[model samples]
Target: MNLFAALPEKERLIAERFDSLIQDIKPLNSKQLAFLPRDIQRLSALLTAERSSLKAGYMNNAVMLSAYTRYFMRWNLFRLTSLFAGMDTTAFDFLKDGDYCLDIGSGPLTVPIALYLARPELRGKKLNWYCMDTSQNALALGENFFLSCAARLQTEEGEPAWRIVRVKGEMGTRIKNKVSFVSCANMFNELYWDTHNPLEKEAKKYAALLLSYTVPQKAVFVVEPGIPRAARFVSLLRSALIRSGMSILAPCPHEGACPMEGKKGGKWCHFILDTESAPKNLQALSEKAGLPKDRAALSFVFASSSPAHQSSSKPAGGKTAGKSAQGASRQHIRICSDPIVLPHGKTGRYACAHWGLTLVTGHRIKDTLSGDLLYADLSAQDIQALPVDRKSGAKIVNV
Candidate 1:
């Protein structure tokens, strides 16, 4: 079953809303869109150029707006839908209490709409949503899309679905007050590669900015493309935030240093979710643009000011976690990376456990995938050794 199958009705509603949004755009037909063949070529070129410009921290908003309205808007809606659909909402259930959400670089209000649909309890709440963007056109388009969506739906309680406060500016020192949750998706990676600044300097700058913006016990979530560089940037940001007294909520299971950082060949952390269930209009756009729309691959970090939410206390299947070969309870090891196949048909994995970065190897571990809350029956010495076997002993417990 697809991830959203559990919430079939909501999934259908979200797809319908997305389809309505796309249909309203009235994409040109083949005869009328004879110019579209050229437009598509131009859009592809613009996207390529914009990517480089985006990395340099100099986005041409007018070009971006054109690209977005012409093609990427539907694509982004699909991306956001997949991301939000696959997410575990229990981690973000705290937002249902009328808390304020500040979405940095919230292009077209994707995060806000995704967040609302992901949490059923949040539907009728009177909440504050601040969308910070550098483009006035982007903000205007976002507000229009959201209002269009809200117009089609009715709340059972008859409350205004959401109140948006749009802020037009660069990310700076003007941290807003009472911002319960801060979301920055696909924004930090650009800032990380700002051509004028060194990467570490840029990462630290954004880290400090986020630290200053959010108060204690609140959460900040960042999402980026799943490529090695972007994923590594997310890891680096996670380390920076954790070192500054923040606790990681998902993706990482331990407070220890990221293993991928020191790996010489540039392996990084990222997750994948199927996006084949995207709205039909989005699928058509993807096909026309020659883009693979089947998968949503991205890296994200969920960090909170509260340390208690750092690690999972249990694993899948209700099994005892963190047991050692010596019969002692050690820290549970959660598999953080996809299993790496070794020469001897052995599978190796990098996991977050008590000893921080752990390398687990065994034939049985081949079945383990990322996001599995895992526990191994091995001593610290055993884990450090080569080719540890899960057949020797390991457990997967219910989280």
Candidate 2:
């Protein structure tokens, strides 16, 4: 039986609350953060642990972190590439009466949950969804969250919008359905660059295969970190889409070489920084991420194009080619008088506060490696059902 189906409506308010939190990237003040149930706070702490380097273990850290971090950390940085590449897929192009959609690297809400939020029009249609993810822990986090969230869907009428048929699989596998959209976000960087998972071969394999099955009305989005691999992927997808007669809806136009060239890829990327009180470790990581080491507050967008991606590859009276995209991206800003803040676990005075909190440690509380607190390394393999423990010990779950 579905666990959430048994809960009363009042018990399910977490989802709506979560949606609000993610939308504005607002952090909870000490007063607001204090209101969260202790259990949820603990959940955040456990899930927020850093353990991306540990591959041999249960990957328990990734699981809990994903379950905990309802969305990307509020202060997470954005570059031009990452911004558009990861531009919330749920927000646009969702069609009414659409038959099927495929979630490539669909970890948690990347598809189903987002579809429900972004596409109210699609609520009328029978949304048949297939979420393909490699991490069991991520899938687990997704399934449980979905179940919990479903219990709380307060509809204008009754019941929630969007019915999902989510499945756990990898991207290369053939999905025979005429996919309305295939969105793959920020995964290519990890796959081709970080893990080098031979996605190059896979891109041609499945993307082309899907295009072969569909007509011009269909679409597929290959989202990556705006690096070389991402650039290559986009270039490949563009070539593939052009070959298949599909048009570019977003990212305006490919401005330059996709930003993912050898060393330049990492340099062009940016990280969010609050220099006044950043932890030494986290600060070092930001610098390593190609951000300025000394700057206290910054937001960046990375793109790999060399202005070739602009609608005009040629410059306009020395105005430059990529300036329109640069201006367009800049004009769409996330400026808020009050930036979202989260507690750093240190009792210090900080301007921002967490709208929500997530526990994300991968190693057992007793394990020394659990001390590292990192995000972005989360996957399906790391999350587990949080069994009560003397301290939060890592639990190896069955996938």
Number of the top TM-score candidate = 1
Clashing pairs in 1: 315-397, 315-398, 316-397, 316-398, 317-398, 318-398
How many residue pairs clash in model 1? 6
List residue ranges in candidate 1 displaced over 4 A. Answer: 1-7, 25-66, 69-89, 96-98, 148-157, 173-176, 262-264, 311-326, 334-340, 344-368, 379-399
TM-score of each: 0.79, 0.46
Candidate 2 per-residue C-alpha lDDT over 1-399 given as tens digits, one digit per residue, 9 for 90 to 100: 000011123322333255343323324445533333342344434333432442422223543343234323211211112233233333244443656766666665444554343333444565566676766566655655555455545455554445555565665666657665556555544444445445446555545765643433455555444334455555555544554445443332232232222233232121232233323433443344333344322221212111222221111221111122221321111111112222453111101001111222222222211001112222332222322222212121110
When summed lDDT is taken over every stretch of 10 residues in candidate 1, the lowest stretch is 390-399
Q: Per-residue lDDT for 189 in model 1?
A: 58
What is the C-alpha local distance difference test score of candidate 2? 0.37
- Candidates in order have lDDT scores of 0.61, 0.37
Q: All predictions: root-mean-square deviation over Cα? A: 4.9, 19.0
